[model samples]
Target chain A: MKFTRRDFTAGLAVGITAPYVIGSARAQGATIKLGMCAPVTGPAAESGGYAVKGARIALEAVNKAGGILGKQAELIVEDDQTTNPGIVLAFSKLAAESDIVAFLGSIRSTQVHAMAPDVLKLGKPVMIGGTDPNLTHMGNQWLFRFRPNDSYSGRVIADYGFNTLGKKKWAVLHSTDAFGTAGGKALGAALEKLGSPAILDQGYANQSQDFTPVVLAIKQSGADILGSYFTYENDIGIFARQLRQLGVNIPWVGSPSITNITALKLAGPALYGTFGVADYAEESSEASKAFGKAYRDVVKVAPDNQSSWPYDAINVLAAAINKAGSTEPAKIREAILATRKFPGAEGEYNFDQNGDGLHGYNIVKNEKGTIVFDKHIEFTD
Target chain B: MNNPQFLLPNAVMDLVLQLLFTGIGIGAVYALVALGFVLIFRATNVVNFAQGEFSMVAAYLMVVFAVDLGWPYWLSFLLSLAGMALLGAIFNLGVYYPLRHRSFLPVIIATIGASILLANSVLAIYGPQPQVLEGWFETPGIQLGPVYLDSQYLLIIAVTIVMVAFNYWFFEHTMLGKKLQATSQDKEMASLLGISVSTMIMITFIYSAVLGGLAGILVAPVLFVSIQMGSTIALKAFAATIIGGFGDVAGAIIGGLALGIIETFGAAYISVPYKDGFAFLVLVLFLVFRPQGIFGERVAEKA
Candidate 1:
């Protein structure tokens, strides 16, 4: 084929751009890309580091076990900075990359809520640890939760407090954030159903320097028991110290944060007798114990819900991807939804219609600064 | 909500006293931080947005020495203050000196940039975990006739009072303090009158940083030493400074205490979730009605 001047110019143009286009395509195909949004630098940065470590561990294990879809999986993390706007920007940055078929979202419900719209727009399955009941039920099909929602935690907290502890009057204290509000509401609903509604339901802003008014309110309420859903560990630490200092020593049952390593360290003796609805109790199950040992060996720290959920999310997502034999968003969604009796570090995963994987919480006590698992409460209905 | 019967005469009085004590405790913290803001603003004619970061860096320094190295609390406290003084000197040189000839806006922006840099640098070196710093007192608190007085809070209030007296004495009596005051009042005139204007500014920065660091070290046990702790307190302290009169020392103290009391009472009587809202609402009201602040004087014409 004899080339004219015009054809020669066209061939030269193709020669220059062809290698660039092909190299980009090859890079994309080399690995199974997974995106993650975490709080690399913010109030939740400590937990975010744990989350990233958990995901990395799971990724290593997945690669060792033939990887996801017969290809080595890679995780690309973007710092959510532990803020709504920060998560939105982080999610958008990850979403802009079309090769990332699935993503790991934040454990904080508010951050997850901030990125929910973007996740829907992308139409890809995103694993999350956020436990807001509304997160799964808010018509966001792409979002799958690895942890039990607040509805179950609320029930478990209320059940353990009212029946086992034999406490009647209750004062429910929670942060005013999305997670805290929903958890508080769910706990209130559960108590009402149990015919022992809380006498004082109080909500306080996050990052509060003092909890005097809150402690005072709880004191005056004359409640025999206290139920709380604190968002940040620092807030919990402050509130717990003040609560005990103010001479109000009612039986306290808190959300998962109460059992967090940070909270335990910060509150110290103040949280000694309190109970928490933990999603990741190391002694709760064999899988949990295994994860705990592995985490302790690798991370050199006790694993909490902050790390456990991400570990479960990564493992579950890999398993679902292998089961589907495809990375298509709908196929992954179906496979994740079909996950049943899947043992995870959090609990036994049985995905419901709303994409909620775990349907229960473990009641653990802060026994002398050590989190001791008391009982596991699973719900079926 | 409190029941009407629960609000008996004794109960009401007890509640008010408790609220007042707690309010003053938290207010003292804001006052300390606000005092830092006031001193720097007075000296440089620029708002040091990094005032909060100064607190944060000092707290981290305390964590490194006291918690990580297991040093004595008293020694760690002194070392942290020393580190803050050095940081203040460097910050003056790096962030303020080059931009000193420029307008106030550049200096203010530089301080903000420095704050971000300081926060991220700490995050990079120490990681993101919040460290627990034990308070100085063995007893957590004491029950004083139906009201609880936290030991740390009592210390904070006492220190704040002492600092106020110290500041008054230092500024009004000492030759160096008079020189610093003169430089702040009229840089050109003070420079002509044989005062080292730059030296006075540097000293002001050092003093402000130490003050900020002191507040952080004091409040670390209560708030926990996290990256966000400084910013959180600083925001409230900034509002306190403005409400107290932007450049007034006494105003900062009063404004901070007033804000602390108002928010505590507001949360108690009105809404807990709107606790921060109450502080900002008061700030907005002050900004609208009394922009010059309670103690600030309005200048009729620019120099």
Candidate 2:
């Protein structure tokens, strides 16, 4: 109780650092938190499950190998409901947490677009799987794309169909949404470059119950080849069946949805012998194969872009955080932007200044319900 | 080569025929779901916003019994309908009966709330993944000359035909059906006549639920069963009901077919992106010109 010199100094020191000590203690309560907006119960819910699993698996490995900044990494997920508004709301809920260092956004381009304004407001680096070319190019510095944008997919689809299939006249079909429209334009541009401008370019709304008009037009167009960019698995499934039914069976190559598990299951034999420019072909790369084996061992399903991109996103994000040696957003963003020659389940991550990680796609063939990886097509530019 | 200027060429004829068949096929699905809407509106004097959820719930039930439990398809079909009947009863007691005396707005809002609850409950239980239901036919479709017929669509068309015939017979010939119609037309009058108005309303709910369930089951194979399936189809069905005449059964069928055909032809000739636009455009035209609907009796506005 006596006010001595040593006691006075000790009391003053304790008073100065008390709040800091309490803050540090509270922070140590759990691992580094990363938020994810996934379709927990909407049209894309099935893929949402895969996305969650992929991020967890990758994060688990990261945690085992020495957690992010020596703290175990934890994932926080909110249901996006496979809708634009749903994703925006879910992301806002997660963003309000304030403790989450970084986030993973939707795979659907439209959903990503929906949450982009809020993401910019939060000023945090968000890894997204949406392949719309405009996603990264729309001057949203905070939005980093884990998957190659649809431009690569469009080019790959057009290249494979025109060169490999040896077909000249083309019928291009696409969904009218952002992803499909960009993809169709890219495909059309590529085909024009290859001297095979599509004789027919048609756009249909998503979730169309029927595709007879589209199919009949394709048949009437007299195109020897078909190229497509579909937004949903079920839409593509319905279209595929109707196409075969209407006898419009020409050499066909489509974007990634054509090779996804849902499309394969729904379309069945109708999709046989078709080509798709998949970003995550299981046999495309050693990393892809490894991820495929790991995913199947755990999820008991074939690996596709839905799961693979998030898997890569976690791996890259964790590594970037490690390299930056901090949980600060600016440091992590720099490390991510500087990521080079980082092998991922999708492909090699060579992020550009604009935040694109991959620059090409893998072409796969659906042969009798089996997806056989054909070849990888990467562009230097 | 010498076909009339107005008449279609052979190639054009084939396209028209295919589109027409597809239009009719999709129209039948809309008609089937629209029937539930019309029936419920007739009984309750309030739109059952959850009519679509009824279809979704029944389809999920079918999936549980038929696919998950691996029961025989026919047995699953029957059990699913039975489940829907029970749900209809619960819905009447919980949703409609409680608000029987309330204005139509609150009841409509309550039905909307029920729809959200039903969809979320299923999502919580089933975890949001779309399920695939195999069609009744092993053969996907049959190619007859230039036109191909999907077996599922064919079955839907056949079922719609049977349902229309059955509805005509039931409403015209059966005492129960007449009692139900009387109750819908005038609940107090029917009760005064000792028709048991509440019982007729209960029966109407059950019948509409069953009808919605039937449409869901029939379309599941084509659309692939998902949580949003009910709402998507219901939107078009709502439009069909409007076009058909709000209270008229036959009007729903004609409206559905007409919408389907118009949309198909519009997409084929005009713009595929505006496919849904065509359906609603026709709806707008009808609303502007014929708000009472095609088959609905001329209703004088209350002065």
Candidate 3:
């Protein structure tokens, strides 16, 4: 307990190593590193890559606009491997880097949930595409959502499917993952609000290759309409095919994954008439149209929610950085919380204290393998 | 529930039958993959976890050769199978042979490593997006009474039968078959009797890889070709292999078909959400009660 020169030298050695341990964190450099955690190589790679592309486009655009705080903004990307542990590791690696001021989180709610604690501990802002409502409301100040949470999308999907389409007797199908379960629960609640309960509520695992039984169950349940929140595009594609094969011609409304180009292409004619709520559509708004056209010029495909949110996320983040005039976390966080009337590929954006921006969902229909935007629904609270 | 009257003029019945047909088609693909798993496991006692990746690689190769290079489907198909066989041989020589005498766990793990490497390599080369294979074989579904079946499904069933028959004949009557069987039964004894155990292992891998390639090529028309396709089918086939008795050839074939039927029926009658779970649940039950599998031979522990 006594102070001595030996102890003082040892304490100084610990202090020096502590700063070294936090690699890239507070590095004496001008470059502002924005960490991007995405699924670059797994089942969700198609969508995740698009998100990364959008983020990169935003990064390039921001750097062109004189960079953030007059310092070059660099995106430090890490593949999340599409698993919880992988995401945690990627986040930790990024968090350890002192120069990384903010991060772009994954589309998987589970991954975001796993990465949230680390993001909070690191005290860095993370813009996320995951729509799980609890992600922002879980007392995590650093977590920012670029897309409207499922709680908003679910009500929109139910309202559109029942009131707009004037169909009742719903069949709700969802993947049994965190996103799907929560989306399904939200949709079911929305349906109940309209005095119509789901005749058949089902949950399938991600990456399922067959959806015959699910389709058959829907057919037998006497449901005239269907709603789903599939976790994987492939599963949604297969399910769409099986549903058509089973002659279930009812109006189908689903969550964002259903509107993915991959699903549309794989399912082909089977998904032609399906409707869903998405964060990004090729034809959402004038701003969205420009973003979509630009994305098509680069990626040679129409933009979906996966591609659009990250585009908006980057633009919003860049705007925040520019407005704050600093790469410091508190300044950027304040600017992000003050986001208002900023046009994005998704829609006009505003960020709450919880970091969720753009409180609207784009209703889209699969019009012969193309996502045709129908309408947009904005929400409060 | 068994009343025939319940079946007539009911859209629900039609839906069930349609699902059954669809499940059968998908299940046929699973059976084909499972057959490959059995072939390699039986001859080499090495569970090729990368069997699915073999199929994926072959399918992608076919896409590259046939679709991209504008070769005929038949030509590309044959070349893809040959390419997979060659890959199998290379894998056996490079990875399996060196680790042949090692524990089964190491061999399994190695296959997993190989699977990851192959999938990632394909991703790196082809990029992550799914590609549709172009060919004349991709015709629209043919109506069959109340239900419809894609021509690709029929082609898959026919090809699977032909391959299964060919494998049966080769294993039962061929000299190479006898040598392989001899090696599988007793590798050291077969080596003493002048049969090359390594060669037999290589041949077995080639055979299985070809089967996997054929599955990929055939199923690609329905599912389209993607790197992740192999892993999904591989898991189902693994379950199928366990159900049929790990090393039982007939069990693998029958077990695959039975699995397809069970999954289809279970999905229709039980629950659609947990359709894949049915196979895994059955696998766990089988492991608990009949670890050797439905048709697997019982082996004594060496220790």
Candidate 4:
């Protein structure tokens, strides 16, 4: 009827502001929302599934025990595709959902590094399983590690090989990615500190079809022991088989990936008798055994660090949220940092200023396919 | 690759022999997959980016038949190849046939889309866990003097050689091969000559799919059967095709072998982390210097 400018301006303003107002209201809904970025499609899809399951199981238990802040907790997951860009994209997607109180990040250090900047920008507590020591020390307050960093793992591997196994000459083999490079360097440094430097420090690319060159380099080095940091289970499988086939059998101790279920299944007999510094050895503690049992009943498979770290991360995040009594980022951060002696599937959570939960690693061995717990090595410093 | 700088004389000899054997073995895989790319490019004048997924899909088919269903290995192998041939036909009908009238860019994009679809489809069906496929040989490997010969690698090399011979006889000496070649050269001329150009194109797709499948099946034991496996090999295979001369048969084989050897030796000598870099570096150099490839005919000469 009467087309007035004032009426049109009022209608335009209402339409423009409606979405933000409605979206903000929806963001403050009933359930507590936590976001997670896991490898739902790419090379790490299998482990990513396990991570999701672990987090789900923890959320289930938390909800059963009366939920977080007296409200039912919920988890929102995004497919990281197991790539650096994938995680960054996944993290951004989760961060955009303003209601999410916290996040569970990638187990991969490369992915964690990729998403670290976003995590810092978002200013929310991010539970991570990436073992790269620099992740916590990189001045990112929002990133909290559920697993022990590689520094502890390197030292443990070195200590076990040198003191326990009495192997002097070592060939340090690692992937060239951020995780592997940092791990290799840490192990090399640890070996040097032990006064038995690595005979050959070799770095290979991930997803390598063949490890002949690296294996041959190890063979030629005349090392009595081999310590490795492989990023993928398939690479480990190929390398382990090639190592034995090339007739260069020696005492081998490796990172957590060596003891992974995927690696065990793939490498089979090739990985037999090798030791790995695991962050979640079932026999390490009652909490670990309980989580392992629960995971087996649900997932119908033996639990590895892939599942354990996420399990611990979810549990700790839930507990921290409850302790803080609010969903505020700074309060949650403080609560997470204050968390001490909190029994988790990975280990007792004693988060230092660096946001690293467990300060030690459990050394486990592969006995003919089954991963058997050997010993636990904890560090005071 | 050259005079030993770090290794002693005897050690150098052993190292060279080992790396050479491994190089040829892995190179044979690249050659097989590259052969598929060459065939499709020659036939359709469009790169089938999904060639790698053909191998991956075949591998998963083998896992389903051989591992899951517990069928005989030989039977599974044949059945997997059959399935791949069927997939190839469907891919041709669905992806290429409709887009045949379109420009090369759309067809190329369609192939890439098909690759993503194929990968995700496998992931959806089989789940994400990488499956272990046992090698045809019971013995893992044999130590031959200084070199360790992997039985799977040996099989891959032997199969590659036989395929090279088969491809030669099929394309050069056979009537059907002549028709296929004729169609690839000029569909209109081939159709005018009473040859069904569409049929020739279909056969090329089937054959290329089978070749890609063979490569996947053979290498499954070495590299575990996974969704990403196809894409990884495809990238290197694509590089091989470019270096070998995109449409040349002999070039695919030699180029694959050359790329494998160069990367292996380069990793050993230069830097292991830059192993993939070495492969693409050679590819870049080839593109810069000999754009037509090792066996490709010069553009001016062809004109």
Top candidate by DockQ = 1
lDDT tens string, model 3, B1-303? Answer: 012224447765665567666766777788899988887877767788999998899889998999899988888988998899899888887778888788888888999999989998999999888877642455566777767776777777777788779878888899998898888788889999999877888888888888899889888766778888899888988888888888777787777777787887776676665778788888899889888788787732310
lDDT of 4 by residue, A257-324 (tens): 99999999999999999999999899989999999999999999999999999899989999989999
Chain A alone, TM-score for each of the models? 0.93, 0.92, 0.91, 0.93
Q: What is the lDDT of residue A155 in candidate 1?
A: 96
lDDT tens digits, residue span B1-303, model 2: 011124358877877788899999999999998999989888877888898888899889989999999999999999999999999999999999989998888999999999999999998898777788888888988988988999999999999999999999999899988998898888889999999888888998999999999999999988888888899888999999889888789998898888888998888888888999999999999889988789877533310
Error of 1 at A54 (Å): 1.1
Candidate 2 at A56: error in angstroms?
0.6
- Stretches off by above 4 angstroms in model 3 are A1-27, B1-23, B101-106, B134-139, B192-194, B301-303
User: Where is the poorest 10-residue window by lDDT in model 2 chain B?
Assistant: B1-10
Candidate 4 backbone clash number: 0
Q: How accurate locally is residue A151 in candidate 3, as Cα lDDT from 0 to 100? A: 87
Instruction: Return the candidate ranking by lDDT, descending.
Output: 4, 1, 2, 3
DockQ of 4: 0.48
lDDT of 4 by residue, B1-303 (tens): 222457678888888999999999999999999999999988988999999999999999999999999999999999999999999999999999999999889999999999999999998989999999999999888889998999999999999999999999999999999999999898898899999988999999999999999999999999999998999999999999889988889999999999999999998777888899999999999989998899987633432
Clashing pairs in 3: A23-A97, A24-A97, A24-A98, A24-A99, A25-A97, A25-A98, A26-A98
For each prediction in turn, the share of the native Cα contacts (below 8 Å between chains A and B) that it retains comes to: 0.90, 0.72, 0.52, 0.70
Interface RMSD of each: 1.4, 4.8, 3.9, 2.9
For candidate 1, write residues B124-211 as lDDT tens digits. 9988888888898988888999989999999999999999999999999999999999998899999999999999999999999999
